[model samples]
Target: MVSCPFAVSCWNKSFPGSQSIHTQVLEVWLEKMFGKYSDNKYADIVTLCWALWRARNDVVWEKKYSRVNRVIASAKQYLLRWKCAPVTCSSVLFRFVVEEDGAITWVRPTRNSIKVTVDATLFAERREYGLGIVARDADGLLVEAKIKCYSGTVTVEYVEALGIKEALSWIKNKGWQEVKLESDCLAVVQAIRCTVEMQSSFGQVVADCRRELRDSNSISLLFIKRSANVVTHCFARASHRYPDRTFDWSDIPIEFQDCIQMESI
Candidate 1:
């Protein structure tokens, strides 16, 4: 794998003077590097190695081209994730299940707590976007749902961050301080959780979410798999149907009614 072009380039760029290391056997080089660096640095090195290996597989098996800069950036992000990971991986009380037909569901929040699930989607051709923000009570009843559409262009990441921003505002506006904001987007979740730093246009949007989250000690951010975010996912997909529209407890679109009913049941 080291001889592969993609793996070779990643190694060369990541380790500047490592031509000699490259010449040695892979196992020997790994042993030498671990011997030289501390545990954390060695962990970063191993994460980068894994990232490069995954990139190689993507190119060969998936027939996809991996950009060198993006690959390096991803490795660095993985390093940060490793460094910032919790000291102890605690078990969650919430149980998620996937059925044979691929339907996924998660447990409801604790009593007196509010849960907000958010999602976003961008239409590249029309230069439009939609963000879905839905809040549920401890009973899993939909307290509120919002569909917001923007006419300007933005990256999917940017819009996802925007959805978090909207969710935070919704909570604050409702005086719901003890709330959990959930999203399927890992980048936004990590950024808000302070596990990863925010960058690019999404930086300010993430900053807004952080500020809102900091205003209340009881607020939390969660990352769930996309499968479990089905309702918000559906809301985001249907966002274009309602431009700049917001719904309260009284008026929800028919398309979202089924998801709400199913969740409530």
Candidate 2:
């Protein structure tokens, strides 16, 4: 499911409690879903999975986009038309309302403060890595955005640590004292907070990030769900394509516009 771009956003929008478990593997997700909605939910889940798979295949093979909501609605319609067993009170307890704008949307920063969001993506097979850092004001206006690349041996954790360190340096250089440094990687965020430490060489990177963060004034390191950090995720993927490119608020490329627009709402 991780390989399917639509799966993450679909589950997040169509189901409640998705933020905590969307990152789980497919089997675990299915297990949790069924466990939570066991009262005649088997048929519902079966229909949902079939719909999503067919929707994904349509995009992959026919070059057509399929909205997740439409697919889910079709699945439900099919179940009703086929006279499937009715869902019970137990299933009602787990019902989730679909989000209209999808899940990967932006969030505002604290009042009178700056928010710096960073993300990193690794392509292990190619030994390539990319980092994205974006800053926005309290009103959610873009302050700056940067994309960086590294062609060396590194893990995703190390790349995330690097993202924190580099983003801090950029923030410090910009003279933003009261700021929030956010990332989607929970392990790295906890490691930076000194709550946990990696035993591998990546531990040193975390240490360096902590030391760098310690010198910053009024900077808060936070972990956010991936859904709320879509802009950074998009930029991280962009960095792999355009290595070492820097885009200011006015100069950001056209591809970023859609995600930014989605979040602005």
Candidate 3:
């Protein structure tokens, strides 16, 4: 049922949405199947859909959809590997209610423009590259996030360079004027601030971002501890699992929805 231009590229577009919901319920109902499932991550879905289905379940389609609340619980149960999670962004959004000053201070609605951070790393274990970028609002709520398998095996420095470039590209495309780019890769900081030419492939990305972002006076780059960049860590793990897919989100599986959520958190 994940058909929206983005759904077609996912293994099969015609797959039943109701069936997906049914499968979710059955996994919760059947302790055996649930036990067998490690992460509830179908290779076709990239952990992202698991979240969208959970957090946004109330945003329904037609009358023939799964119970929104159950879907959220099932997704949480499946992901947490426990009967339930203590609390998550989705859970808070769905359950929390506060009356504050008749004025809505913050909301996590789909964002239009936001400040962002990006990280790219190449696993020394496999030599594969990973890229992830996350957009956050002024209040630090996540808007949209993405991770992808970088094409071809690459060097560590190059992956870091590519990560910064990708982050800049993301902001520019979104028409963001001032972005505070951060990365754990020291090489990336050197590449941007020091103007040292990176490896050829990564250099191209860096060059592109420099050109695109340079025109803006608001953009700046910073270096952060790797532990601070958790989204990219998840993304790096994901790059190892689903090494390659089309660039479009439609081509990715549902599991990635969780990755996006995790990054935001």
Candidate 4:
């Protein structure tokens, strides 16, 4: 975009067009706003422009915003999650047995409250993560069952930690007050019970999660052998990518793609 006379003006022979200062400024602004738009040419450009304009107004008129501050805070939060982690002590695993009646009668609880078993297995070649949770209700009939798929891959310890978190979080989010969480991973269950604080950043994460869970009066953390959580173990194994049947009495989530496999009740 230029101003003033040239030897031959395309505008002069073809047509005359008006250029406003605001239009030039808007172009520069849109470049910053839509550099990523190359991948989404069909996106709503008008809505994007309106939002950017509004944000600018809020900062200019109300002195209320700073992009740098927001980005920095988000980065800090992401880093904190990595820095603060629990110590990976040796884990204890329990094995669950399948009764002849095909019903789970009981799960021996270790450490406390009615125990619930949780596990996760991932097949890197299959590009999938399997998640399972088991708990015996009042009737001792395997009252609750949960299984699903995930997309990320990490070590077995990380997966076990995530599985426990998911099980406990499910109860918390549902507003349940009392529940015992059971897992085969001894190290993880211990991390959930006693607080670990080593001035190291990794310890910080474990301590933080401990503090958050500690406030929940209704929750208890316990350890059990992997064999004690038979159903979930089978479900975890069934999540293999080789195309097989899997069974689950609960409503399967679409992301799990369980139907493509063989075993689901």
Best by TM-score: 2
lDDT of 2 at 44: 75
For model 2, residues 74-121, the per-residue Cα lDDT tens digits are 555555535523433355553322221112235677788888889999
- Angstrom error of the Cα, residue 248, model 4: value is 8.2
Instruction: List pairs with backbone clashes in candidate 1.
Output: none
What lDDT, from 0 to 1, does candidate 2 have?
0.74
Clashes of each: 0, 0, 18, 29
Which regions of candidate 4 fall more than 4 Å away from where they truly are? 1-114, 198-208, 239-265
The TM-scores, one per candidate, come to 0.58, 0.60, 0.47, 0.45
Estimate, for each residue in 1-265, the C-alpha lDDT of model 4 and write its tens digit: 2232320132122112222212335566345435534534313343323334454567679996534223222222223333333322332442223111111222443333344667778778866777777654443434456666777666666677777767776666656555767666677656655655556443454565577577788776665544344445655665554223323335443323321121122
Model 4 lowest lDDT segment of ten:
96-105
**Clash pairs of candidate 2?**
none
Q: Candidate 3's residue-wise lDDT over 1-265, tens digit each?
A: 2443332323133223323332434345234323444554342243335544443444555433333323442343344333223434454454322221111111222334355556766666665677777666665555556677755677777777776776776677777755666666665565665567666786777777677667777676665545345544555567666554323344444554444443333
Off by over 4 Å in 1: 1-104, 195-199
> Per-model C-alpha lDDT, please?
0.72, 0.74, 0.52, 0.49
* Model 2 lDDT, residue 205, Cα: 80
Give candidate 3's total backbone clashes.
Answer: 18
Worst 10 residues of 1 by lDDT: 94-103
Model 2 is weakest, by summed lDDT over 10 consecutive residues, at 95-104
